[model samples]
Structure formats: C-alpha cells, structure tokens
Target: MPVCPYCQVEMDDDLDTCPNCGITMIYFFKCQRCGQEFATTGILKFCPLCDADLSEQMN
Candidate 1:
C-alpha cells in the first residue's frame, strides 16, 4: 500500500483511483494553498510541483 499525498489516505500501489478521496493516484507535489496535488514532468499553469499558481510566482 502507498499513502496519497493529497489527502494522506492509504491506497493500493497498483490501483488508479483513491478509495477515500476518489483522486487519481499519481506522482505530484501538493499545493499548500488549494490542497491540489498536480502531475509533474511537464509544463503546468500551477505548481505541478506544488499546485501553487505559477502566475503568482511570476510577480
């Protein structure tokens, strides 16, 4: 079993969706503000690294 970062819920390593939160299990960094963890390894509007809006950082 693996722990989900979004909700800190436990889930099967091979499974796709989370049994508790219903979020798709994936590799991501959680955003401190919205509590939304996003996928990495690609360009994203937010902190796929943390789900933080990148536009805010651009300032």
Candidate 2:
C-alpha cells in the first residue's frame, strides 16, 4: 500500500490526491485490487477504474 507522505495514511496508489490530507502534485493512488491509477479533484467513494469500494479502505 502506498502511504500518504503528509497524512501518513494508507492510500490507493492510483490516486493523485491524498484522501486524508488532500495533497496533490506529488501523492497518487494505485488500486490495491486492480492496480489502476487515476486523478481526483475531491474525495471519491469508489474507484472509476475498477469500481472498488474506496470508502471502506479509508478507515
């Protein structure tokens, strides 16, 4: 799992923004299940690439 360098939370490596700290331009998310990468403007509940339930992983 890729960790948010700022928030220190386990993040989906496919995302370019930290779900906890909202950091961008550096951090990104990669799907733990599908290993797909994507960008985000805000908190997402599911992965657009694989439709993974991202909310459950946040906690």
Q: Top lDDT: which candidate number? A: 2
| Per-residue lDDT over 1-59 for candidate 1, one digit per residue giving the tens place of the 0 to 100 score | 77777898887656667788887744445566767655644334576444466554321
lDDT of every model, 2 decimals: 0.60, 0.69
Error at 33, model 1, angstroms: 37
RMSD values for the candidates in order, in angstroms, are 10.0, 7.6
Mark the regions of model 2 whose C-alpha exceeds 4 Å error after superposition: 1-27, 57-59
Q: Which candidate tops TM-score?
A: 2
lDDT of 2 by residue, 2-59 (tens): 6777778887757767788888734246677798876666557788878887776553
Could you tell me which 10 consecutive residues in candidate 2 have the lowest summed lDDT? 24-33
Question: Candidate 2: lDDT of 56?
Answer: 60
Question: What is the Cα root-mean-square deviation between model 1 and the actual structure?
Answer: 10.0
Question: Candidate 1: where are CA atoms >4 Å away?
Answer: 28-59
